[model samples]
Target: MTRKRQGQQGWGPEHPEQHYLVQPRTVAGGGDVRHVSEYLRASGWRDRSKRGGPLLVESPDRTLRVAYDPHGQPGGWTIHGKATGSTQEWSAHLGRQTPVEIVAGITDTLPLPRSAHAPNVWGPLADGGWHARFEGNSYSATSPDGTAWLQYRQEANGTALWWTGATDTRGNSWTGAFTPTTPLHVVQAFSAQLASPEPVMRPRGRVPHSSKIRTWSVSVTPSQLGAWQQARINAARAATWARNSRRTDRPSTSAPPYANAGSVRTRR
Candidate 1:
Protein backbone atom coordinates (compact mmCIF):
# COMPACT_ATOMS: atom_id res chain seq x y z
CA MET A 1 0.00 0.00 0.00
CA THR A 2 1.18 3.55 -0.65
CA ARG A 3 2.24 5.41 2.44
CA LYS A 4 -0.90 7.01 3.85
CA ARG A 5 0.08 10.43 5.06
CA GLN A 6 -0.74 11.91 8.44
CA GLY A 7 -3.17 14.46 7.07
CA GLN A 8 -6.88 14.86 7.81
CA GLN A 9 -7.95 11.86 9.89
CA GLY A 10 -11.67 11.37 9.55
CA TRP A 11 -13.99 9.33 7.37
CA GLY A 12 -17.00 10.93 5.66
CA PRO A 13 -20.57 10.39 6.85
CA GLU A 14 -21.25 7.62 4.36
CA HIS A 15 -20.73 3.87 4.26
CA PRO A 16 -18.35 2.76 7.03
CA GLU A 17 -17.24 -0.24 4.97
CA GLN A 18 -15.72 2.09 2.41
CA HIS A 19 -13.10 3.13 4.99
CA TYR A 20 -10.59 1.07 7.01
CA LEU A 21 -11.44 0.80 10.68
CA VAL A 22 -10.33 -0.88 13.93
CA GLN A 23 -12.60 -3.04 16.06
CA PRO A 24 -11.03 -4.38 19.26
CA ARG A 25 -14.08 -6.13 20.69
CA THR A 26 -14.57 -8.21 17.57
CA VAL A 27 -12.72 -11.36 16.50
CA ALA A 28 -10.93 -9.04 14.10
CA GLY A 29 -9.62 -7.26 17.17
CA GLY A 30 -7.82 -10.30 18.71
CA GLY A 31 -10.73 -11.87 20.55
CA ASP A 32 -9.82 -15.50 19.67
CA VAL A 33 -7.58 -16.15 22.66
CA ARG A 34 -10.10 -17.34 25.22
CA HIS A 35 -11.52 -19.96 22.87
CA VAL A 36 -8.10 -21.09 21.67
CA SER A 37 -6.82 -21.35 25.21
CA GLU A 38 -9.81 -23.48 26.08
CA TYR A 39 -9.09 -25.56 23.01
CA LEU A 40 -5.52 -26.06 24.16
CA ARG A 41 -6.69 -27.24 27.58
CA ALA A 42 -9.12 -29.66 26.04
CA SER A 43 -6.47 -30.95 23.68
CA GLY A 44 -4.13 -32.26 26.40
CA TRP A 45 -1.99 -29.22 27.16
CA ARG A 46 -1.71 -28.33 30.84
CA ASP A 47 -2.71 -25.04 32.35
CA ARG A 48 0.34 -24.00 34.31
CA SER A 49 -0.86 -20.68 35.61
CA LYS A 50 -0.11 -19.38 39.11
CA ARG A 51 -1.90 -16.59 40.91
CA GLY A 52 -0.64 -13.07 40.09
CA GLY A 53 1.80 -14.35 37.53
CA PRO A 54 1.91 -14.65 33.79
CA LEU A 55 -0.83 -16.93 32.43
CA LEU A 56 1.17 -20.00 31.49
CA VAL A 57 0.62 -23.29 29.63
CA GLU A 58 3.05 -26.01 28.64
CA SER A 59 3.08 -28.85 26.18
CA PRO A 60 2.76 -32.37 27.56
CA ASP A 61 6.44 -33.07 26.96
CA ARG A 62 7.27 -29.80 28.71
CA THR A 63 9.18 -28.55 25.71
CA LEU A 64 6.75 -25.83 24.61
CA ARG A 65 5.67 -22.90 26.74
CA VAL A 66 3.36 -19.97 26.15
CA ALA A 67 3.38 -17.04 28.51
CA TYR A 68 1.59 -13.73 28.79
CA ASP A 69 3.37 -11.32 31.10
CA PRO A 70 2.48 -7.66 31.05
CA HIS A 71 5.96 -6.74 32.28
CA GLY A 72 7.86 -9.01 29.93
CA GLN A 73 10.71 -7.06 28.38
CA PRO A 74 10.40 -6.18 24.71
CA GLY A 75 7.26 -8.31 24.42
CA GLY A 76 4.24 -9.04 26.58
CA TRP A 77 3.38 -12.31 24.80
CA THR A 78 5.96 -15.01 24.16
CA ILE A 79 6.10 -18.62 22.96
CA HIS A 80 9.29 -20.57 23.51
CA GLY A 81 9.95 -24.18 22.58
CA LYS A 82 12.95 -26.47 22.83
CA ALA A 83 13.53 -30.04 21.75
CA THR A 84 13.43 -32.39 24.71
CA GLY A 85 16.99 -33.23 25.87
CA SER A 86 18.45 -31.38 22.92
CA THR A 87 19.95 -27.93 22.46
CA GLN A 88 17.64 -27.03 19.56
CA GLU A 89 15.30 -24.20 20.48
CA TRP A 90 13.24 -21.43 18.91
CA SER A 91 10.94 -18.68 20.08
CA ALA A 92 8.27 -16.29 18.76
CA HIS A 93 7.17 -13.11 20.44
CA LEU A 94 4.59 -10.35 20.10
CA GLY A 95 4.87 -6.98 21.78
CA ARG A 96 2.04 -5.43 23.78
CA GLN A 97 1.53 -3.02 20.90
CA THR A 98 0.68 -5.93 18.61
CA PRO A 99 -2.96 -6.35 17.69
CA VAL A 100 -4.76 -9.10 19.59
CA GLU A 101 -6.21 -10.40 16.33
CA ILE A 102 -2.74 -10.78 14.88
CA VAL A 103 -1.60 -12.55 18.02
CA ALA A 104 -4.51 -14.99 17.64
CA GLY A 105 -3.21 -15.82 14.19
CA ILE A 106 -0.14 -17.25 15.88
CA THR A 107 -1.84 -19.11 18.73
CA ASP A 108 -4.75 -20.69 16.82
CA THR A 109 -2.60 -23.26 15.05
CA LEU A 110 -0.48 -24.51 17.90
CA PRO A 111 -2.22 -27.86 18.37
CA LEU A 112 -1.37 -29.52 15.05
CA PRO A 113 1.98 -30.71 13.78
CA ARG A 114 3.90 -28.76 11.21
CA SER A 115 3.65 -29.76 7.56
CA ALA A 116 6.58 -31.24 5.66
CA HIS A 117 6.07 -28.67 2.95
CA ALA A 118 7.35 -25.32 4.15
CA PRO A 119 4.90 -22.54 4.89
CA ASN A 120 4.27 -20.57 1.67
CA VAL A 121 3.64 -17.05 2.92
CA TRP A 122 2.98 -15.79 -0.56
CA GLY A 123 0.42 -18.38 -1.60
CA PRO A 124 -2.47 -16.78 0.25
CA LEU A 125 -1.65 -13.29 -1.05
CA ALA A 126 -1.45 -14.60 -4.58
CA ASP A 127 -4.86 -16.25 -4.22
CA GLY A 128 -6.25 -13.03 -2.79
CA GLY A 129 -5.06 -11.10 -5.89
CA TRP A 130 -2.81 -8.76 -3.96
CA HIS A 131 0.09 -7.16 -5.81
CA ALA A 132 3.27 -8.94 -4.76
CA ARG A 133 6.78 -7.58 -4.84
CA PHE A 134 9.77 -9.79 -4.29
CA GLU A 135 13.47 -9.14 -3.70
CA GLY A 136 16.26 -11.47 -2.53
CA ASN A 137 14.87 -12.33 0.92
CA SER A 138 12.26 -9.61 1.34
CA TYR A 139 8.70 -9.60 0.04
CA SER A 140 5.46 -7.66 0.40
CA ALA A 141 1.85 -7.95 -0.75
CA THR A 142 -0.55 -5.06 -0.83
CA SER A 143 -4.33 -5.24 -1.13
CA PRO A 144 -5.89 -4.11 -4.39
CA ASP A 145 -7.44 -1.10 -2.69
CA GLY A 146 -4.14 -0.16 -0.98
CA THR A 147 -5.79 -0.62 2.41
CA ALA A 148 -3.90 -3.71 3.71
CA TRP A 149 -0.39 -5.16 3.41
CA LEU A 150 1.91 -7.99 4.48
CA GLN A 151 5.68 -7.72 4.52
CA TYR A 152 8.22 -10.48 5.09
CA ARG A 153 11.97 -10.81 5.36
CA GLN A 154 12.96 -14.46 5.39
CA GLU A 155 16.05 -15.88 7.04
CA ALA A 156 17.22 -19.49 6.97
CA ASN A 157 17.09 -19.56 10.75
CA GLY A 158 13.58 -18.12 10.88
CA THR A 159 14.42 -15.04 12.96
CA ALA A 160 13.53 -12.32 10.49
CA LEU A 161 10.49 -10.14 11.19
CA TRP A 162 7.31 -10.26 9.11
CA TRP A 163 4.88 -7.36 9.30
CA THR A 164 1.12 -7.22 8.69
CA GLY A 165 -0.79 -3.97 8.56
CA ALA A 166 -3.75 -1.96 7.29
CA THR A 167 -4.24 1.71 6.47
CA ASP A 168 -6.84 4.13 5.20
CA THR A 169 -6.80 7.36 3.20
CA ARG A 170 -7.44 9.04 6.53
CA GLY A 171 -3.92 8.12 7.75
CA ASN A 172 -5.33 5.70 10.29
CA SER A 173 -3.36 2.44 10.40
CA TRP A 174 -2.78 -0.71 12.47
CA THR A 175 0.18 -3.09 12.47
CA GLY A 176 1.51 -6.25 14.07
CA ALA A 177 4.88 -7.94 13.62
CA PHE A 178 6.39 -11.33 14.43
CA THR A 179 9.32 -13.55 13.51
CA PRO A 180 9.33 -16.14 10.74
CA THR A 181 9.10 -18.91 13.36
CA THR A 182 5.85 -17.44 14.71
CA PRO A 183 4.08 -20.58 13.37
CA LEU A 184 2.46 -21.37 10.03
CA HIS A 185 -1.07 -21.19 11.40
CA VAL A 186 -0.58 -17.52 12.29
CA VAL A 187 0.41 -16.72 8.74
CA GLN A 188 -2.60 -18.58 7.36
CA ALA A 189 -4.97 -16.94 9.85
CA PHE A 190 -3.76 -13.44 9.06
CA SER A 191 -3.93 -14.10 5.33
CA ALA A 192 -7.40 -15.63 5.48
CA GLN A 193 -8.76 -12.70 7.46
CA LEU A 194 -7.13 -10.13 5.19
CA ALA A 195 -8.60 -11.77 2.14
CA SER A 196 -12.13 -12.05 3.55
CA PRO A 197 -14.67 -9.41 2.47
CA GLU A 198 -16.93 -9.55 5.52
CA PRO A 199 -17.35 -6.77 8.06
CA VAL A 200 -16.07 -6.86 11.64
CA MET A 201 -18.16 -5.95 14.67
CA ARG A 202 -16.35 -3.61 17.05
CA PRO A 203 -17.51 -2.08 20.30
CA ARG A 204 -16.69 1.52 21.22
CA GLY A 205 -13.18 1.97 22.53
CA ARG A 206 -9.93 3.65 21.57
CA VAL A 207 -7.88 1.71 19.02
CA PRO A 208 -4.28 0.92 19.83
CA HIS A 209 -2.31 2.94 17.29
CA SER A 210 -4.99 5.13 15.64
CA SER A 211 -7.41 7.82 16.73
CA LYS A 212 -11.04 6.82 17.35
CA ILE A 213 -12.32 9.95 15.63
CA ARG A 214 -10.44 9.13 12.45
CA THR A 215 -12.44 5.99 11.59
CA TRP A 216 -16.11 5.10 11.68
CA SER A 217 -17.75 2.49 13.97
CA VAL A 218 -21.35 1.41 14.37
CA SER A 219 -23.10 -0.43 17.16
CA VAL A 220 -23.45 -4.16 16.53
CA THR A 221 -27.09 -5.21 16.06
CA PRO A 222 -28.74 -8.33 17.52
CA SER A 223 -29.60 -9.72 14.09
CA GLN A 224 -26.05 -9.24 12.89
CA LEU A 225 -24.79 -11.04 15.99
CA GLY A 226 -27.14 -13.95 15.57
CA ALA A 227 -26.35 -14.33 11.90
CA TRP A 228 -22.60 -14.33 12.42
CA GLN A 229 -22.87 -16.78 15.29
CA GLN A 230 -25.06 -19.17 13.32
CA ALA A 231 -22.73 -19.03 10.36
CA ARG A 232 -19.81 -19.90 12.60
CA ILE A 233 -21.67 -22.84 14.14
CA ASN A 234 -22.75 -24.21 10.77
CA ALA A 235 -19.28 -23.91 9.32
CA ALA A 236 -17.76 -25.79 12.26
CA ARG A 237 -20.38 -28.51 12.05
CA ALA A 238 -19.80 -28.93 8.33
CA ALA A 239 -16.09 -29.28 8.85
CA THR A 240 -16.53 -31.94 11.51
CA TRP A 241 -19.02 -33.83 9.42
CA ALA A 242 -16.77 -33.79 6.40
CA ARG A 243 -13.79 -35.00 8.38
CA ASN A 244 -15.78 -37.86 9.90
CA SER A 245 -17.12 -38.85 6.50
CA ARG A 246 -13.63 -38.96 5.04
CA ARG A 247 -12.43 -41.12 7.92
CA THR A 248 -15.19 -43.61 7.28
CA ASP A 249 -14.21 -43.97 3.66
CA ARG A 250 -10.90 -45.68 4.54
CA PRO A 251 -9.50 -47.90 7.26
CA SER A 252 -7.33 -45.32 9.04
CA THR A 253 -4.62 -46.36 11.43
CA SER A 254 -4.25 -42.91 12.91
CA ALA A 255 -4.50 -39.20 12.33
CA PRO A 256 -3.09 -36.08 13.95
CA PRO A 257 -4.23 -35.77 17.55
CA TYR A 258 -4.69 -32.40 19.17
CA ALA A 259 -1.29 -31.66 20.71
CA ASN A 260 -0.71 -35.45 20.51
CA ALA A 261 -1.61 -35.75 24.18
CA GLY A 262 -4.19 -37.96 25.84
CA SER A 263 -5.04 -35.82 28.87
CA VAL A 264 -4.54 -32.35 30.36
CA ARG A 265 -3.66 -31.42 33.92
CA THR A 266 -2.72 -28.56 36.20
CA ARG A 267 0.52 -28.57 38.14
CA ARG A 268 0.32 -30.29 41.50
Candidate 2:
Protein backbone atom coordinates (compact mmCIF):
# COMPACT_ATOMS: atom_id res chain seq x y z
CA MET A 1 0.00 0.00 0.00
CA THR A 2 2.64 2.54 1.12
CA ARG A 3 6.33 2.75 1.92
CA LYS A 4 7.31 3.80 5.44
CA ARG A 5 10.05 6.36 5.98
CA GLN A 6 12.33 6.62 9.00
CA GLY A 7 11.42 8.84 12.04
CA GLN A 8 7.87 7.51 12.59
CA GLN A 9 7.19 6.38 16.17
CA GLY A 10 4.45 3.93 15.14
CA TRP A 11 5.23 0.67 13.30
CA GLY A 12 3.31 -1.63 10.96
CA PRO A 13 3.44 -5.13 9.45
CA GLU A 14 6.06 -4.52 6.75
CA HIS A 15 8.07 -2.01 8.78
CA PRO A 16 7.76 -2.90 12.47
CA GLU A 17 9.29 -0.47 14.97
CA GLN A 18 11.10 -3.22 16.89
CA HIS A 19 14.89 -3.40 16.58
CA TYR A 20 17.05 -6.39 17.49
CA LEU A 21 19.72 -4.96 19.79
CA VAL A 22 22.48 -7.27 20.99
CA GLN A 23 24.26 -6.72 24.29
CA PRO A 24 27.95 -5.98 23.69
CA ARG A 25 30.48 -8.45 25.12
CA THR A 26 32.75 -6.26 27.27
CA VAL A 27 35.63 -8.53 28.34
CA ALA A 28 38.37 -10.14 26.26
CA GLY A 29 38.72 -13.93 26.02
CA GLY A 30 35.00 -13.98 25.29
CA GLY A 31 34.40 -12.58 28.80
CA ASP A 32 35.97 -15.61 30.46
CA VAL A 33 39.53 -14.87 31.64
CA ARG A 34 39.44 -13.04 34.98
CA HIS A 35 42.55 -12.36 37.05
CA VAL A 36 45.94 -12.50 35.30
CA SER A 37 47.52 -14.18 38.35
CA GLU A 38 44.78 -16.83 38.49
CA TYR A 39 45.33 -17.65 34.81
CA LEU A 40 49.13 -17.91 35.24
CA ARG A 41 48.80 -20.26 38.24
CA ALA A 42 46.50 -22.66 36.38
CA SER A 43 48.65 -22.73 33.23
CA GLY A 44 51.08 -25.68 33.01
CA TRP A 45 54.22 -23.55 33.36
CA ARG A 46 55.31 -19.91 33.57
CA ASP A 47 58.53 -18.19 32.42
CA ARG A 48 59.94 -18.30 35.99
CA SER A 49 63.49 -17.94 34.59
CA LYS A 50 62.28 -15.11 32.27
CA ARG A 51 64.89 -16.25 29.69
CA GLY A 52 62.12 -17.67 27.40
CA GLY A 53 63.64 -21.09 28.01
CA PRO A 54 60.59 -23.48 28.06
CA LEU A 55 57.32 -22.37 29.67
CA LEU A 56 56.70 -25.94 30.95
CA VAL A 57 59.18 -27.74 33.18
CA GLU A 58 60.72 -30.80 31.49
CA SER A 59 59.36 -34.14 32.76
CA PRO A 60 61.81 -36.89 33.71
CA ASP A 61 60.82 -38.87 30.59
CA ARG A 62 60.85 -35.63 28.45
CA THR A 63 57.88 -36.90 26.45
CA LEU A 64 55.47 -33.91 26.54
CA ARG A 65 55.85 -30.23 27.34
CA VAL A 66 52.78 -28.19 28.45
CA ALA A 67 53.00 -24.51 27.54
CA TYR A 68 50.46 -21.70 27.92
CA ASP A 69 49.57 -19.36 25.10
CA PRO A 70 47.31 -16.75 26.74
CA HIS A 71 46.81 -15.32 23.30
CA GLY A 72 46.53 -17.73 20.39
CA GLN A 73 49.76 -17.07 18.43
CA PRO A 74 50.05 -15.50 14.94
CA GLY A 75 46.58 -13.91 15.16
CA GLY A 76 47.25 -12.68 18.76
CA TRP A 77 43.51 -13.05 19.56
CA THR A 78 42.90 -14.81 22.90
CA ILE A 79 41.15 -18.17 22.80
CA HIS A 80 39.32 -18.51 26.12
CA GLY A 81 36.60 -21.14 25.63
CA LYS A 82 35.86 -24.38 23.83
CA ALA A 83 32.66 -25.80 22.39
CA THR A 84 31.04 -28.60 24.36
CA GLY A 85 29.93 -31.96 22.86
CA SER A 86 31.62 -31.29 19.52
CA THR A 87 31.95 -34.44 17.38
CA GLN A 88 35.27 -33.24 15.95
CA GLU A 89 37.57 -32.13 18.74
CA TRP A 90 38.39 -28.44 18.18
CA SER A 91 42.00 -27.49 18.76
CA ALA A 92 44.29 -24.50 18.37
CA HIS A 93 46.62 -25.04 15.39
CA LEU A 94 49.59 -22.72 14.96
CA GLY A 95 51.68 -22.71 11.82
CA ARG A 96 51.22 -26.51 11.97
CA GLN A 97 48.00 -28.57 12.14
CA THR A 98 48.12 -30.18 15.59
CA PRO A 99 45.27 -31.91 17.41
CA VAL A 100 45.74 -29.80 20.54
CA GLU A 101 47.72 -26.69 21.34
CA ILE A 102 48.41 -25.71 24.93
CA VAL A 103 46.06 -22.89 25.83
CA ALA A 104 45.08 -20.94 28.94
CA GLY A 105 42.31 -22.66 30.88
CA ILE A 106 38.86 -21.36 30.03
CA THR A 107 37.84 -19.80 33.32
CA ASP A 108 34.09 -19.61 32.59
CA THR A 109 31.56 -19.74 29.77
CA LEU A 110 27.89 -18.85 29.37
CA PRO A 111 25.27 -21.54 28.81
CA LEU A 112 22.79 -21.18 25.97
CA PRO A 113 19.05 -21.45 26.66
CA ARG A 114 17.86 -25.07 26.62
CA SER A 115 15.14 -24.37 24.03
CA ALA A 116 17.60 -22.91 21.50
CA HIS A 117 20.66 -24.99 22.36
CA ALA A 118 19.64 -27.67 19.87
CA PRO A 119 21.04 -27.71 16.33
CA ASN A 120 17.60 -28.45 14.82
CA VAL A 121 16.33 -24.93 15.44
CA TRP A 122 17.70 -22.66 12.72
CA GLY A 123 19.59 -19.50 13.62
CA PRO A 124 19.36 -16.27 11.68
CA LEU A 125 21.40 -16.47 8.44
CA ALA A 126 20.75 -12.76 7.81
CA ASP A 127 23.30 -9.89 7.32
CA GLY A 128 25.11 -10.84 10.47
CA GLY A 129 24.11 -13.92 12.46
CA TRP A 130 21.20 -11.99 13.95
CA HIS A 131 18.39 -13.89 15.67
CA ALA A 132 15.19 -13.09 13.78
CA ARG A 133 12.19 -11.96 15.86
CA PHE A 134 8.87 -11.06 14.19
CA GLU A 135 6.95 -8.16 15.66
CA GLY A 136 3.12 -7.68 15.32
CA ASN A 137 2.82 -11.09 13.59
CA SER A 138 4.15 -10.19 10.16
CA TYR A 139 4.54 -12.27 6.97
CA SER A 140 7.20 -12.85 4.21
CA ALA A 141 6.94 -14.39 0.78
CA THR A 142 9.05 -15.59 -2.15
CA SER A 143 8.64 -17.29 -5.54
CA PRO A 144 10.75 -19.76 -7.52
CA ASP A 145 10.13 -18.17 -10.95
CA GLY A 146 8.93 -14.82 -12.22
CA THR A 147 6.17 -16.38 -14.34
CA ALA A 148 4.88 -18.76 -11.69
CA TRP A 149 3.67 -17.50 -8.26
CA LEU A 150 3.53 -19.20 -4.88
CA GLN A 151 2.25 -18.55 -1.32
CA TYR A 152 3.38 -16.27 1.52
CA ARG A 153 4.02 -17.19 5.17
CA GLN A 154 3.29 -15.72 8.58
CA GLU A 155 5.74 -15.46 11.49
CA ALA A 156 5.24 -19.10 12.53
CA ASN A 157 5.73 -20.28 8.95
CA GLY A 158 8.34 -17.66 8.13
CA THR A 159 11.14 -19.93 9.34
CA ALA A 160 10.04 -22.71 6.97
CA LEU A 161 10.54 -20.54 3.88
CA TRP A 162 13.91 -19.42 2.57
CA TRP A 163 14.46 -15.94 1.12
CA THR A 164 16.45 -17.03 -1.93
CA GLY A 165 16.47 -14.31 -4.56
CA ALA A 166 16.81 -16.91 -7.31
CA THR A 167 13.14 -16.57 -8.37
CA ASP A 168 14.01 -13.27 -9.98
CA THR A 169 16.92 -13.88 -12.37
CA ARG A 170 17.52 -10.16 -12.59
CA GLY A 171 17.32 -10.57 -8.78
CA ASN A 172 14.72 -7.95 -7.95
CA SER A 173 12.26 -7.79 -5.02
CA TRP A 174 9.48 -10.26 -4.07
CA THR A 175 5.83 -10.00 -3.04
CA GLY A 176 3.41 -12.51 -1.51
CA ALA A 177 0.00 -12.87 0.04
CA PHE A 178 -0.71 -13.68 3.70
CA THR A 179 -4.08 -15.43 3.92
CA PRO A 180 -5.43 -16.31 7.36
CA THR A 181 -6.65 -19.91 7.35
CA THR A 182 -7.22 -20.32 11.08
CA PRO A 183 -7.19 -17.65 13.75
CA LEU A 184 -3.60 -18.55 14.59
CA HIS A 185 -2.22 -19.64 11.21
CA VAL A 186 -1.67 -17.86 7.87
CA VAL A 187 -0.34 -18.71 4.38
CA GLN A 188 1.89 -16.90 1.86
CA ALA A 189 1.56 -16.33 -1.93
CA PHE A 190 4.37 -14.63 -3.79
CA SER A 191 5.46 -12.80 -6.97
CA ALA A 192 8.49 -10.70 -7.92
CA GLN A 193 7.87 -6.95 -8.30
CA LEU A 194 10.99 -5.48 -9.90
CA ALA A 195 14.46 -6.55 -11.13
CA SER A 196 17.58 -6.75 -8.91
CA PRO A 197 18.81 -3.23 -9.73
CA GLU A 198 15.80 -1.51 -8.07
CA PRO A 199 13.96 -3.60 -5.46
CA VAL A 200 10.77 -3.05 -3.49
CA MET A 201 8.32 -5.10 -1.40
CA ARG A 202 5.10 -5.79 -3.37
CA PRO A 203 1.68 -6.74 -1.98
CA ARG A 204 -0.20 -9.89 -3.06
CA GLY A 205 -3.55 -11.24 -1.89
CA ARG A 206 -6.48 -13.31 -3.14
CA VAL A 207 -8.59 -11.37 -5.61
CA PRO A 208 -12.18 -12.28 -6.47
CA HIS A 209 -12.08 -15.09 -9.03
CA SER A 210 -13.18 -14.77 -12.74
CA SER A 211 -10.07 -13.01 -14.05
CA LYS A 212 -6.99 -14.84 -15.41
CA ILE A 213 -4.54 -16.56 -12.99
CA ARG A 214 -2.03 -13.68 -13.38
CA THR A 215 -2.45 -9.94 -13.01
CA TRP A 216 -0.04 -7.08 -13.73
CA SER A 217 0.20 -3.94 -11.63
CA VAL A 218 2.41 -0.82 -11.66
CA SER A 219 4.96 -0.28 -8.90
CA VAL A 220 4.54 2.68 -6.55
CA THR A 221 7.26 5.34 -6.44
CA PRO A 222 9.35 5.82 -3.28
CA SER A 223 7.51 9.01 -2.20
CA GLN A 224 4.07 7.47 -2.68
CA LEU A 225 5.17 4.36 -0.81
CA GLY A 226 6.35 6.46 2.10
CA ALA A 227 2.93 8.09 2.51
CA TRP A 228 1.21 4.68 2.41
CA GLN A 229 3.54 3.25 5.08
CA GLN A 230 2.82 6.18 7.41
CA ALA A 231 -0.91 5.71 6.94
CA ARG A 232 -0.74 2.02 7.88
CA ILE A 233 1.44 2.78 10.91
CA ASN A 234 -1.03 5.42 12.13
CA ALA A 235 -3.89 2.96 11.71
CA ALA A 236 -2.11 0.21 13.67
CA ARG A 237 -1.20 2.63 16.48
CA ALA A 238 -4.78 3.87 16.69
CA ALA A 239 -6.02 0.28 16.90
CA THR A 240 -3.53 -0.55 19.68
CA TRP A 241 -4.54 2.62 21.53
CA ALA A 242 -8.23 1.72 21.28
CA ARG A 243 -7.66 -1.82 22.55
CA ASN A 244 -5.67 -0.56 25.58
CA SER A 245 -8.19 2.19 26.31
CA ARG A 246 -10.98 -0.36 26.84
CA ARG A 247 -8.99 -1.91 29.73
CA THR A 248 -7.66 1.39 31.16
CA ASP A 249 -8.01 2.15 34.91
CA ARG A 250 -8.85 5.79 35.62
CA PRO A 251 -7.87 6.78 39.18
CA SER A 252 -9.61 9.80 40.73
CA THR A 253 -7.27 12.50 42.04
CA SER A 254 -8.50 14.69 44.93
CA ALA A 255 -5.48 16.94 45.61
CA PRO A 256 -3.49 19.34 43.45
CA PRO A 257 0.18 18.64 42.55
CA TYR A 258 1.49 20.34 45.80
CA ALA A 259 -1.51 19.68 48.15
CA ASN A 260 -1.44 16.65 50.50
CA ALA A 261 1.06 14.91 48.18
CA GLY A 262 1.33 11.69 50.20
CA SER A 263 -2.39 11.31 51.04
CA VAL A 264 -4.69 9.03 49.03
CA ARG A 265 -8.16 10.18 48.01
CA THR A 266 -11.06 8.68 49.98
CA ARG A 267 -14.72 8.66 48.88
CA ARG A 268 -17.47 9.02 51.54
Best by lDDT: 1
Q: What is the C-alpha lDDT of each candidate?
A: 0.52, 0.23
Candidate 1 lDDT by residue in tens digits, 159-209: 588777665433344465666555565477557555544333334443334
Clashing pairs in 1: 30-100, 30-101, 105-186
Name the best candidate (by TM-score). Answer: 1
Off by over 4 Å in 2: 1-166, 173-184, 188-226, 246-268
lDDT of 2 by residue, 45-125 (tens): 232323643233221223222233433443212212223342221222121111110111111111101222322112112
In model 1, where do residues sit more than 4 Å from their true spots?
1-36, 84-88, 114-118, 144-148, 154-186, 194-196, 206-268
Q: Lowest summed lDDT over 10 consecutive residues: which window, candidate 2?
A: 20-29
Question: What is the RMSD of candidate 1?
Answer: 15.4
